[model samples]
Target chain A: SQTIHQWPATLVQPVGSPLSLECTVEGTSNPNLYWYRQAAGRGLQLLFYSVGIGQISSEVPQNLSASRPQDRQFILSSKKLLLSDSGFYLCAWSVRGPTEAFFGQGTRLTVV
Target chain B: GESVGLHLPTLSVQEGDNSIINCAYSNSASDYFIWYKQESGKGPQFIIDIRSNMDKRQGQRVTVLLNKTVKHLSLQIAATQPGDSAVYFCADSYSGSARQLTFGSGTQLTVLP
Candidate 1:
Protein backbone atom coordinates (compact mmCIF):
# COMPACT_ATOMS: atom_id res chain seq x y z
CA SER A 1 0.00 0.00 0.00
CA GLN A 2 2.79 2.41 -0.81
CA THR A 3 1.87 5.73 -2.42
CA ILE A 4 3.93 8.50 -4.02
CA HIS A 5 2.86 12.13 -3.89
CA GLN A 6 4.20 14.79 -6.26
CA TRP A 7 3.37 18.49 -6.50
CA PRO A 8 2.47 20.83 -7.86
CA ALA A 9 0.46 18.81 -10.35
CA THR A 10 1.10 21.52 -12.94
CA LEU A 11 3.52 24.40 -13.01
CA VAL A 12 4.20 27.45 -15.20
CA GLN A 13 7.52 29.20 -14.81
CA PRO A 14 9.15 32.11 -16.55
CA VAL A 15 12.41 31.63 -18.39
CA GLY A 16 15.52 31.95 -16.20
CA SER A 17 13.37 31.54 -13.07
CA PRO A 18 14.15 29.02 -10.39
CA LEU A 19 12.15 25.79 -10.13
CA SER A 20 11.49 23.16 -7.50
CA LEU A 21 9.46 19.95 -7.60
CA GLU A 22 8.96 17.63 -4.67
CA CYS A 23 8.15 13.93 -4.40
CA THR A 24 7.71 11.76 -1.33
CA VAL A 25 6.87 8.14 -0.73
CA GLU A 26 4.68 6.93 2.11
CA GLY A 27 4.64 3.39 3.55
CA THR A 28 8.11 2.53 2.31
CA SER A 29 11.59 3.17 3.65
CA ASN A 30 14.98 3.19 1.95
CA PRO A 31 13.41 2.84 -1.47
CA ASN A 32 15.21 3.73 -4.69
CA LEU A 33 13.95 7.00 -6.14
CA TYR A 34 14.22 8.21 -9.69
CA TRP A 35 13.50 11.33 -11.73
CA TYR A 36 12.37 11.17 -15.33
CA ARG A 37 11.33 13.63 -18.01
CA GLN A 38 9.11 12.94 -20.98
CA ALA A 39 9.28 15.29 -23.92
CA ALA A 40 7.02 15.42 -26.94
CA GLY A 41 7.66 12.25 -28.96
CA ARG A 42 11.04 11.78 -27.28
CA GLY A 43 9.82 9.23 -24.74
CA LEU A 44 10.68 9.00 -21.06
CA GLN A 45 14.29 9.85 -20.23
CA LEU A 46 15.94 9.17 -16.93
CA LEU A 47 17.37 12.30 -15.41
CA PHE A 48 18.53 11.16 -12.01
CA TYR A 49 18.31 8.33 -9.48
CA SER A 50 19.18 7.93 -5.84
CA VAL A 51 20.05 4.81 -3.85
CA GLY A 52 20.03 6.45 -0.46
CA ILE A 53 19.98 9.76 1.29
CA GLY A 54 22.50 12.30 -0.06
CA GLN A 55 23.31 9.96 -2.93
CA ILE A 56 22.22 10.97 -6.40
CA SER A 57 23.26 9.72 -9.83
CA SER A 58 22.79 11.78 -12.96
CA GLU A 59 21.80 9.85 -16.01
CA VAL A 60 21.91 12.79 -18.35
CA PRO A 61 23.62 16.13 -18.05
CA GLN A 62 21.27 19.08 -18.01
CA ASN A 63 20.22 22.11 -16.04
CA LEU A 64 18.10 20.06 -13.61
CA SER A 65 19.42 18.41 -10.45
CA ALA A 66 17.94 15.98 -7.92
CA SER A 67 18.43 15.52 -4.21
CA ARG A 68 17.35 12.95 -1.65
CA PRO A 69 17.01 15.00 1.51
CA GLN A 70 15.33 12.21 3.46
CA ASP A 71 14.73 8.49 3.14
CA ARG A 72 11.31 9.09 1.59
CA GLN A 73 11.59 12.62 0.29
CA PHE A 74 13.14 13.54 -3.08
CA ILE A 75 13.34 16.91 -4.71
CA LEU A 76 14.19 18.11 -8.23
CA SER A 77 15.45 21.63 -8.56
CA SER A 78 17.00 24.05 -10.97
CA LYS A 79 18.67 27.37 -10.29
CA LYS A 80 17.63 28.80 -13.64
CA LEU A 81 15.08 27.19 -15.92
CA LEU A 82 15.37 27.05 -19.69
CA LEU A 83 12.76 26.71 -22.43
CA SER A 84 14.04 23.19 -23.16
CA ASP A 85 13.38 22.25 -19.53
CA SER A 86 9.64 22.14 -20.17
CA GLY A 87 8.31 18.63 -20.03
CA PHE A 88 6.29 16.17 -17.94
CA TYR A 89 8.43 15.32 -14.91
CA LEU A 90 7.79 12.05 -13.13
CA CYS A 91 9.05 10.55 -9.86
CA ALA A 92 9.30 6.82 -9.34
CA TRP A 93 10.27 4.36 -6.60
CA SER A 94 11.42 0.79 -6.66
CA VAL A 95 12.83 -1.90 -4.42
CA ARG A 96 16.54 -2.63 -4.02
CA GLY A 97 16.76 -5.19 -6.79
CA PRO A 98 15.66 -5.05 -10.37
CA THR A 99 11.89 -4.73 -10.10
CA GLU A 100 8.97 -2.81 -11.44
CA ALA A 101 8.93 0.86 -10.49
CA PHE A 102 5.87 2.76 -9.22
CA PHE A 103 5.43 6.28 -10.61
CA GLY A 104 3.68 9.30 -9.24
CA GLN A 105 1.00 11.35 -10.99
CA GLY A 106 3.75 13.57 -12.52
CA THR A 107 4.21 17.35 -12.79
CA ARG A 108 3.60 19.12 -16.07
CA LEU A 109 6.11 21.98 -16.21
CA THR A 110 5.90 24.69 -18.82
CA VAL A 111 8.66 27.30 -19.10
CA VAL A 112 7.46 30.33 -20.97
CA GLY B 1 25.16 1.18 -24.12
CA GLU B 2 21.50 0.35 -23.52
CA SER B 3 18.96 1.14 -26.19
CA VAL B 4 15.32 0.07 -26.32
CA GLY B 5 13.04 0.70 -29.28
CA LEU B 6 9.58 -0.12 -30.53
CA HIS B 7 8.63 -1.56 -33.88
CA LEU B 8 5.68 0.73 -34.56
CA PRO B 9 4.66 4.21 -33.54
CA THR B 10 0.91 3.62 -33.60
CA LEU B 11 -1.55 0.74 -33.63
CA SER B 12 -5.32 0.79 -34.19
CA VAL B 13 -7.49 -2.13 -33.21
CA GLN B 14 -11.20 -2.92 -32.96
CA GLU B 15 -12.85 -3.37 -29.63
CA GLY B 16 -13.03 -6.97 -28.40
CA ASP B 17 -10.14 -7.90 -30.65
CA ASN B 18 -6.71 -8.91 -29.54
CA SER B 19 -3.89 -6.38 -29.53
CA ILE B 20 -0.17 -6.93 -29.72
CA ILE B 21 2.66 -4.46 -29.17
CA ASN B 22 6.26 -5.23 -30.06
CA CYS B 23 9.60 -3.89 -28.77
CA ALA B 24 13.30 -4.48 -29.42
CA TYR B 25 16.39 -3.92 -27.37
CA SER B 26 20.10 -3.71 -28.14
CA ASN B 27 21.66 -4.73 -24.85
CA SER B 28 22.13 -8.44 -24.56
CA ALA B 29 22.84 -8.12 -20.85
CA SER B 30 19.31 -6.95 -20.15
CA ASP B 31 17.57 -9.61 -18.12
CA TYR B 32 14.35 -7.92 -17.12
CA PHE B 33 11.65 -6.40 -19.34
CA ILE B 34 8.46 -4.51 -18.52
CA TRP B 35 5.44 -3.10 -20.31
CA TYR B 36 3.71 0.07 -19.23
CA LYS B 37 0.48 1.85 -20.20
CA GLN B 38 0.38 5.61 -20.13
CA GLU B 39 -2.63 7.87 -20.48
CA SER B 40 -2.50 11.45 -21.63
CA GLY B 41 -0.87 13.75 -19.11
CA LYS B 42 -0.29 10.92 -16.63
CA GLY B 43 2.52 8.67 -15.48
CA PRO B 44 3.00 5.33 -17.10
CA GLN B 45 1.28 2.45 -15.28
CA PHE B 46 2.87 -0.97 -14.99
CA ILE B 47 0.96 -3.57 -16.96
CA ILE B 48 3.20 -6.66 -17.00
CA ASP B 49 6.80 -7.84 -16.67
CA ILE B 50 8.88 -10.83 -17.68
CA ARG B 51 12.27 -12.10 -16.57
CA SER B 52 14.89 -13.48 -18.88
CA ASN B 53 14.67 -16.89 -17.26
CA MET B 54 11.06 -17.15 -18.36
CA ASP B 55 9.93 -16.57 -21.87
CA LYS B 56 6.37 -15.65 -20.97
CA ARG B 57 4.39 -14.22 -18.08
CA GLN B 58 0.70 -13.46 -17.71
CA GLY B 59 -1.27 -10.99 -15.64
CA GLN B 60 -5.02 -10.42 -15.37
CA ARG B 61 -5.66 -9.77 -19.06
CA VAL B 62 -2.17 -8.95 -20.21
CA THR B 63 0.74 -11.14 -21.31
CA VAL B 64 4.43 -10.36 -21.79
CA LEU B 65 6.72 -12.39 -24.01
CA LEU B 66 10.49 -12.12 -24.00
CA ASN B 67 12.86 -13.42 -26.65
CA LYS B 68 16.45 -13.15 -25.59
CA THR B 69 17.84 -14.52 -28.80
CA VAL B 70 16.31 -11.78 -30.86
CA LYS B 71 16.34 -9.26 -28.02
CA HIS B 72 12.68 -8.64 -28.59
CA LEU B 73 9.71 -8.19 -26.28
CA SER B 74 5.96 -8.15 -26.84
CA LEU B 75 2.79 -7.36 -24.94
CA GLN B 76 -0.58 -8.92 -25.76
CA ILE B 77 -3.97 -7.77 -24.51
CA ALA B 78 -6.96 -10.03 -24.69
CA ALA B 79 -10.34 -8.71 -25.81
CA THR B 80 -9.19 -5.14 -26.11
CA GLN B 81 -11.59 -2.52 -24.76
CA PRO B 82 -11.89 1.21 -24.98
CA GLY B 83 -10.18 1.50 -21.63
CA ASP B 84 -7.17 -0.25 -23.13
CA SER B 85 -6.51 2.68 -25.40
CA ALA B 86 -3.26 4.27 -24.37
CA VAL B 87 0.42 4.61 -25.21
CA TYR B 88 2.28 1.40 -24.50
CA PHE B 89 5.99 1.44 -23.69
CA CYS B 90 8.48 -1.36 -23.09
CA ALA B 91 11.51 -1.02 -20.85
CA ASP B 92 14.59 -3.16 -20.30
CA SER B 93 17.24 -3.36 -17.61
CA TYR B 94 20.10 -5.50 -16.38
CA SER B 95 19.63 -8.02 -13.57
CA GLY B 96 22.50 -7.94 -11.06
CA SER B 97 23.41 -4.38 -10.08
CA ALA B 98 22.37 -2.00 -12.82
CA ARG B 99 18.85 -0.99 -11.95
CA GLN B 100 18.39 1.95 -14.29
CA LEU B 101 15.94 1.28 -17.12
CA THR B 102 15.95 2.15 -20.81
CA PHE B 103 12.49 2.78 -22.26
CA GLY B 104 11.24 2.45 -25.79
CA SER B 105 9.67 5.29 -27.75
CA GLY B 106 6.20 3.75 -27.20
CA THR B 107 3.32 2.80 -29.46
CA GLN B 108 -0.02 4.61 -29.37
CA LEU B 109 -2.80 2.02 -29.24
CA THR B 110 -6.16 3.33 -30.35
CA VAL B 111 -9.18 1.11 -29.72
CA LEU B 112 -12.00 1.70 -32.18
CA PRO B 113 -15.36 1.43 -30.54
Candidate 2:
Protein backbone atom coordinates (compact mmCIF):
# COMPACT_ATOMS: atom_id res chain seq x y z
CA SER A 1 0.00 0.00 0.00
CA GLN A 2 1.18 3.51 -0.78
CA THR A 3 0.70 6.48 1.51
CA ILE A 4 1.33 10.20 1.22
CA HIS A 5 2.34 12.49 4.08
CA GLN A 6 1.81 16.25 4.04
CA TRP A 7 2.58 18.74 6.77
CA PRO A 8 2.03 20.84 8.67
CA ALA A 9 -1.59 19.69 8.62
CA THR A 10 -2.58 23.32 9.24
CA LEU A 11 -0.59 26.54 8.75
CA VAL A 12 -1.04 30.21 9.57
CA GLN A 13 1.26 32.58 7.77
CA PRO A 14 1.55 36.32 7.76
CA VAL A 15 1.19 38.22 4.53
CA GLY A 16 4.45 38.49 2.53
CA SER A 17 5.97 35.68 4.55
CA PRO A 18 7.66 32.79 2.83
CA LEU A 19 5.98 29.40 2.76
CA SER A 20 6.87 25.80 2.09
CA LEU A 21 4.69 22.69 2.13
CA GLU A 22 6.10 19.23 1.74
CA CYS A 23 4.59 16.00 0.40
CA THR A 24 6.21 12.59 0.10
CA VAL A 25 4.98 9.23 -1.03
CA GLU A 26 5.92 5.85 0.39
CA GLY A 27 5.71 2.36 -1.10
CA THR A 28 5.91 3.71 -4.63
CA SER A 29 8.72 5.00 -6.82
CA ASN A 30 8.67 7.36 -9.77
CA PRO A 31 5.00 8.18 -9.20
CA ASN A 32 3.38 11.28 -10.63
CA LEU A 33 2.84 13.94 -7.96
CA TYR A 34 0.44 16.86 -8.07
CA TRP A 35 -0.55 19.89 -6.03
CA TYR A 36 -4.11 21.16 -5.93
CA ARG A 37 -5.80 23.95 -4.04
CA GLN A 38 -9.44 24.21 -3.05
CA ALA A 39 -11.22 27.25 -1.76
CA ALA A 40 -13.82 26.87 0.91
CA GLY A 41 -16.93 25.28 -0.60
CA ARG A 42 -15.24 25.08 -4.00
CA GLY A 43 -13.69 22.38 -6.13
CA LEU A 44 -10.02 21.62 -6.61
CA GLN A 45 -7.80 23.69 -8.88
CA LEU A 46 -4.70 22.07 -10.22
CA LEU A 47 -1.57 24.03 -9.41
CA PHE A 48 1.44 21.90 -10.30
CA TYR A 49 2.50 18.38 -11.21
CA SER A 50 5.75 16.53 -11.54
CA VAL A 51 6.69 13.53 -13.62
CA GLY A 52 10.14 12.91 -12.19
CA ILE A 53 12.83 14.45 -10.09
CA GLY A 54 13.71 18.02 -11.06
CA GLN A 55 10.75 18.09 -13.44
CA ILE A 56 7.73 20.21 -12.49
CA SER A 57 4.82 21.39 -14.56
CA SER A 58 2.69 24.39 -13.61
CA GLU A 59 -0.96 24.20 -14.46
CA VAL A 60 -1.79 27.72 -13.34
CA PRO A 61 0.35 30.77 -12.89
CA GLN A 62 0.21 32.18 -9.40
CA ASN A 63 2.27 32.83 -6.27
CA LEU A 64 3.15 29.17 -5.75
CA SER A 65 5.80 26.88 -7.22
CA ALA A 66 6.59 23.19 -6.94
CA SER A 67 9.83 21.25 -6.94
CA ARG A 68 10.48 17.55 -7.04
CA PRO A 69 13.68 17.14 -5.04
CA GLN A 70 13.46 13.36 -4.97
CA ASP A 71 11.65 10.59 -6.71
CA ARG A 72 8.83 10.59 -4.16
CA GLN A 73 9.34 13.92 -2.43
CA PHE A 74 7.58 17.01 -3.70
CA ILE A 75 7.55 20.48 -2.20
CA LEU A 76 5.32 23.48 -2.84
CA SER A 77 6.88 26.81 -2.01
CA SER A 78 6.41 30.53 -2.29
CA LYS A 79 8.77 33.37 -1.71
CA LYS A 80 5.98 35.53 -0.37
CA LEU A 81 2.45 34.65 0.61
CA LEU A 82 -0.57 36.61 -0.49
CA LEU A 83 -4.05 36.75 1.00
CA SER A 84 -5.32 35.01 -2.09
CA ASP A 85 -2.92 32.15 -1.41
CA SER A 86 -4.99 30.93 1.48
CA GLY A 87 -6.71 27.68 0.70
CA PHE A 88 -6.71 23.97 1.45
CA TYR A 89 -3.66 22.57 -0.36
CA LEU A 90 -3.77 18.91 -1.24
CA CYS A 91 -1.06 16.60 -2.58
CA ALA A 92 -1.87 13.64 -4.75
CA TRP A 93 -0.07 10.79 -6.49
CA SER A 94 -0.92 8.59 -9.44
CA VAL A 95 0.62 5.98 -11.66
CA ARG A 96 2.15 6.81 -15.05
CA GLY A 97 -1.03 6.37 -17.05
CA PRO A 98 -4.61 7.51 -16.70
CA THR A 99 -5.69 6.07 -13.40
CA GLU A 100 -7.37 6.93 -10.12
CA ALA A 101 -5.30 9.21 -7.91
CA PHE A 102 -4.61 9.01 -4.19
CA PHE A 103 -4.52 12.04 -1.89
CA GLY A 104 -2.92 13.07 1.31
CA GLN A 105 -4.69 14.56 4.35
CA GLY A 106 -3.99 18.09 2.99
CA THR A 107 -2.65 21.30 4.50
CA ARG A 108 -5.04 24.08 5.42
CA LEU A 109 -3.05 27.27 4.83
CA THR A 110 -4.36 30.52 6.20
CA VAL A 111 -2.52 33.66 5.06
CA VAL A 112 -3.50 36.56 7.24
CA GLY B 1 -9.41 24.47 -23.94
CA GLU B 2 -10.79 21.89 -21.52
CA SER B 3 -13.50 22.48 -18.98
CA VAL B 4 -15.37 20.20 -16.59
CA GLY B 5 -18.56 21.37 -14.92
CA LEU B 6 -21.35 20.09 -12.74
CA HIS B 7 -25.04 20.51 -13.43
CA LEU B 8 -25.84 21.46 -9.81
CA PRO B 9 -23.86 23.12 -7.06
CA THR B 10 -25.66 21.34 -4.26
CA LEU B 11 -27.95 18.40 -3.54
CA SER B 12 -29.89 17.20 -0.50
CA VAL B 13 -30.95 13.61 -0.18
CA GLN B 14 -32.59 11.42 2.42
CA GLU B 15 -30.63 8.65 4.06
CA GLY B 16 -31.07 5.20 2.54
CA ASP B 17 -32.15 6.82 -0.74
CA ASN B 18 -30.19 6.75 -3.93
CA SER B 19 -28.18 9.83 -4.88
CA ILE B 20 -27.09 10.91 -8.30
CA ILE B 21 -24.61 13.65 -9.21
CA ASN B 22 -24.14 14.78 -12.76
CA CYS B 23 -21.13 16.31 -14.53
CA ALA B 24 -20.42 17.65 -17.99
CA TYR B 25 -17.24 18.34 -19.88
CA SER B 26 -16.35 20.40 -22.92
CA ASN B 27 -13.42 18.43 -24.27
CA SER B 28 -14.51 15.84 -26.78
CA ALA B 29 -11.06 14.29 -26.57
CA SER B 30 -11.59 13.40 -22.94
CA ASP B 31 -11.27 9.65 -22.57
CA TYR B 32 -11.26 9.29 -18.79
CA PHE B 33 -13.53 10.46 -15.98
CA ILE B 34 -13.48 10.17 -12.20
CA TRP B 35 -15.63 10.96 -9.17
CA TYR B 36 -14.25 12.08 -5.82
CA LYS B 37 -15.69 12.66 -2.36
CA GLN B 38 -14.24 15.19 0.04
CA GLU B 39 -15.02 15.72 3.69
CA SER B 40 -14.90 19.12 5.39
CA GLY B 41 -11.12 19.39 5.70
CA LYS B 42 -9.78 16.27 4.08
CA GLY B 43 -8.46 15.61 0.64
CA PRO B 44 -10.87 14.24 -1.94
CA GLN B 45 -11.24 10.47 -1.90
CA PHE B 46 -11.47 8.44 -5.08
CA ILE B 47 -14.96 6.97 -5.37
CA ILE B 48 -15.18 5.65 -8.89
CA ASP B 49 -13.92 6.14 -12.45
CA ILE B 50 -14.91 5.26 -16.01
CA ARG B 51 -13.15 5.39 -19.33
CA SER B 52 -14.54 6.43 -22.70
CA ASN B 53 -14.31 2.86 -23.94
CA MET B 54 -16.72 1.76 -21.22
CA ASP B 55 -19.97 3.55 -20.53
CA LYS B 56 -20.30 2.30 -16.98
CA ARG B 57 -18.18 1.16 -14.07
CA GLN B 58 -19.11 0.10 -10.55
CA GLY B 59 -17.40 0.14 -7.21
CA GLN B 60 -18.50 -1.09 -3.83
CA ARG B 61 -21.62 1.06 -3.60
CA VAL B 62 -20.88 3.60 -6.27
CA THR B 63 -21.47 3.67 -10.00
CA VAL B 64 -20.01 5.95 -12.67
CA LEU B 65 -21.65 6.37 -16.06
CA LEU B 66 -19.93 8.06 -18.96
CA ASN B 67 -21.62 9.41 -22.06
CA LYS B 68 -19.07 10.53 -24.60
CA THR B 69 -21.64 11.73 -27.08
CA VAL B 70 -23.01 14.24 -24.60
CA LYS B 71 -19.70 14.66 -22.82
CA HIS B 72 -21.47 13.87 -19.58
CA LEU B 73 -20.81 11.57 -16.64
CA SER B 74 -22.78 10.70 -13.53
CA LEU B 75 -22.14 9.16 -10.15
CA GLN B 76 -24.77 7.18 -8.33
CA ILE B 77 -24.44 6.28 -4.67
CA ALA B 78 -26.68 3.50 -3.44
CA ALA B 79 -28.45 3.72 -0.11
CA THR B 80 -26.95 7.03 0.78
CA GLN B 81 -25.88 7.40 4.39
CA PRO B 82 -25.01 10.24 6.72
CA GLY B 83 -21.39 9.51 6.04
CA ASP B 84 -22.01 10.41 2.43
CA SER B 85 -22.46 14.08 3.29
CA ALA B 86 -19.63 15.77 1.48
CA VAL B 87 -18.66 17.62 -1.65
CA TYR B 88 -18.45 15.55 -4.83
CA PHE B 89 -16.28 16.49 -7.78
CA CYS B 90 -16.06 14.96 -11.23
CA ALA B 91 -12.84 15.09 -13.21
CA ASP B 92 -12.03 14.57 -16.87
CA SER B 93 -8.83 13.75 -18.70
CA TYR B 94 -7.79 12.89 -22.21
CA SER B 95 -5.34 10.12 -22.98
CA GLY B 96 -2.75 12.59 -24.20
CA SER B 97 -2.62 14.08 -20.70
CA ALA B 98 -4.27 11.56 -18.46
CA ARG B 99 -2.21 12.67 -15.47
CA GLN B 100 -3.52 16.17 -15.84
CA LEU B 101 -7.10 16.29 -14.57
CA THR B 102 -9.67 19.05 -14.93
CA PHE B 103 -12.11 19.11 -12.04
CA GLY B 104 -15.65 20.36 -12.03
CA SER B 105 -16.94 22.80 -9.48
CA GLY B 106 -17.91 20.39 -6.77
CA THR B 107 -21.49 19.62 -5.75
CA GLN B 108 -22.29 19.63 -2.06
CA LEU B 109 -24.27 16.53 -1.16
CA THR B 110 -26.09 16.77 2.12
CA VAL B 111 -27.58 13.58 3.45
CA LEU B 112 -30.53 14.12 5.73
CA PRO B 113 -30.57 11.66 8.57
Best by DockQ: 2
Predicted candidate 1 versus true structure: per-residue lDDT over A83-111, tens digit per residue: 99999999999988879999999999999
lDDT of 1 by residue, B3-103 (tens): 79999999999999999999999999998889999999899999988889999999998988888999989999999999999999999889643588889
Shift in Å, residue A104, candidate 1:
0.4
Interface RMSD of 2: 1.2
Candidate 2 clashing pairs?
none
Clashing pairs in 1: none
Clashing residue pairs in all predictions, respectively, total 0, 0
Stretches of candidate 1 above 4 Å error?
A: none
Model 2 per-residue lDDT at A98: 84
Best-fitting candidate, scored by lDDT: 1
Query: What's the lDDT for candidate 1?
Result: 0.92
